[model samples]
Target: MTVTDFDFICQILRQRSGLVLGNDKAYLLESRLLPVARKYKLASFEDLVRLIRVKSDEAVIKDVVEAMTTNESFFFRDTKPFDQFKQIVLPTLMAARPNKQIRIWSAAASSGQECYSLAMILSEMAAQLSGWKIEILGTDLSTEILDRAREGIYSQFEAQRGLPINLLVKYFTQVGDRWQINQKIRSMVQYKEFNLLNDPRSLGKFDVVFCRNVLIYFDQPTKAKILNNIAGLMPNDGYLFLGGAETVLGITDKFQLLAGQRGVYGLTTGQAAPATKPAAPGALRA
Candidate 1:
């Protein structure tokens, strides 16, 4: 593809999904969008861009944007966040909220693994959360992945990564060569199609949010906007989990690193009214 074609595609991605593509990413565009070009029976990437130029379709834009959006995720990705969540965050929150209700958002939840991981951890504390209300919301921009997440199935290799053997055995039943998260864990979470670039207020507020590993794609301004919107929906004492490589430092002041915790953040001050009970699972689908 010519530089002009590459730049056009990059512009389209940025407009559609807030992905910032640099001039050096020509190879990446070819690697990811070539198959999309072929799928539409276009002769080459140039032809794909030509089609978009002449007759832009919303579906085509969506396909190209989703094709470029990174959906890398796995169960308990990066051990420290889950450890902090299970060990300190949950305990402190439980003590503070005697109502015994918890709501968590797995932002950019690629395929529900992270959400289910949270469920399993909570389930392990079932005796303590026996009468409590718990809801896990898993949202992603890709409809296809959200569908897969709802199905609760994973390949052996996918399950092996970050999923401990004992927990895997307890929570998943082998189906032929693949593993499926048990219905009990699956029922505790719900999936929805969401975009971080859009306003997030409609999704309702969350006490614990897992918006991990997704902000690095955006430019600094876009990143700041997204972090502010995320903060807008969290209570003062709420917790936010970002990827280890991502941080709030030099980004936004809405959150600060939780005291004595790594990869965990808390609101700086002020509290939103706690979210009411979440609707039954499947009701929040986009």
Candidate 2:
């Protein structure tokens, strides 16, 4: 693609998805979008760019954006965030929520592993949460991935990634070579198509949010804007879990790190910290 075409594609991604692509990733345009071009029967990448520029087909634009957005996810990815949820967040919320209801959001929840991981945890504690109402909403920019997430099926390789052997055996049934999460676990979560660039107030309030491994893709100002928007969707005392490499420090003050917690943060103007202690560090891979 030409320089002008490259810049135009960058603008479309930033405006639609808040993703900021630099010149260093210029090579990705062809590697990723070429298949999209061929899928639409375009002659070449140049022709695809011209179609987007001249005719501006919304379908093509949507596919282009979805194609570029990274959807890398795995069961209980990175371990610590799920540990925090099970050990600290859930117990605290159980005590504080008078109505016995908890709502959670997994933003950019690629293929639903993260939210489902939380569901599995909740299922393990079913006796304690017998009378509670729990809602887990997993939203992503890609409709295609959200469909996969809703199906709750995974290949053997995906099933094994960071998922414990006992939980896998208990919660999943082998469908041919792929494993499908049980109906009870799948029904505990919902999926939606959402863009982080847009407001989240319509999704309603959440007690806990897992917007992990997503902010690192945007620029500084976009990062701050998205963080502030997320803060609005959460209560003063709600918890936010980011990727191990991401932080609210220097980016936004709406949240502050929990003392001794690695990837967990609570609202700055919220209530006191939870009484639970930090979990011991260990690898949780299967």
Candidate 3:
């Protein structure tokens, strides 16, 4: 593709999704959107861009955006966060608000593995949380991924990644060569197509928010804006889990690192709560 075509496509992606695409990422655009181009019978990437520029078609635009948005995820993809969630965060929340309902938001919940992982944890602790109401909301920017998330099926390899043998046996049923998460676990979570850059306050407040591995895509200002927006939708003591490589430091003062809880952040003082350091990567098993 020409420089002009690449620049135009990159601009559209950033405007719509807050994804920063440097000049070096030409290969990414080509690889990811090639299917969209071919499906539309466009002769080349240039043809795709030409059609996009002229028609500004909603379907075409949506396809392009979804294709470009990264959806890489796995069951309990990173270990520490889930460990902190089950051992500390969940218990703390339960004790802090006994007899109250609890909600979790997996903001970048691609394909639902993260949300389902959470469901499995909650299910394991069902006896402890018996009388309380709980729900997991998995939101993504791609409707295509959300649809698959709702289906809750995984390939054999997908089922194995970061998933323990016992839990797998208990929670999934084999269908042909794939595994389908049981209805009991699937029922605990809801999937929605949502954009983080947009206002999410209408969804109501959450007790914990998992926006892991998502903010790395945005520029600083956009990152802070999204962080502040998330803060607005969480309670004063709500928990936030970022990716292993992500942190609220140097980004926003809205959240403080929870003491001794690696990858787990809480509200700061006054508007927020105290936060501790996160654990080292790969410290906890899934």
Output the number of the TM-score-best candidate: 2
Give each model a TM-score: 0.92, 0.96, 0.94
lDDT by residue for model 2 (69-170), tens? 999999988787887888888888888899999999999999989988999988888899999999999999899999999999999999999889988999
Candidate 2, lDDT over the whole model: 0.89
Give candidate 1 regions above 4 Å deviation: 270-286
* Candidate 3 segments whose C-alpha is farther than 4 A from its true place: 270-286
Ranking by lDDT: 2, 3, 1
TM-score of 2: 0.96
**Best model per lDDT:** 2
> Which lDDT tens digits does candidate 3 get at residues 1-286?
7899999998998889999998999999998888999989997888899999899998999999999999999998777788788777777788788656899999989999999999988888889988889989999989999998999999999999999888899999999999999999999999888898899988788999999999988999999999999989888779999988888889899888887567778778423333434445543433
Q: Model 1 lDDT vs. the true structure?
A: 0.85
How close is each model in CA RMSD to the real structure? 6.6, 1.7, 2.5
- Estimate every model's Cα lDDT from 0 to 1: 0.85, 0.89, 0.87
lDDT of 2 at 284: 33
lDDT at position 240, candidate 2: 90
- What is the per-residue lDDT of model 1 for residues 1-286, given as tens digits with 9 covering 90 to 100? 8988888899988877899998888989888988888989998888888888999977777888988998888887877677777766777788778888888999999888899889988888889888899889999999988999999999999999888788888889999999999999999999999998899999998989998998889999988999999999987889899998899889999988876566788888944223333234322111
The lowest-lDDT stretch of 10 consecutive residues in candidate 2 is 277-286
Question: Which should have the higher TM-score, number 1 or number 3?
Answer: 3
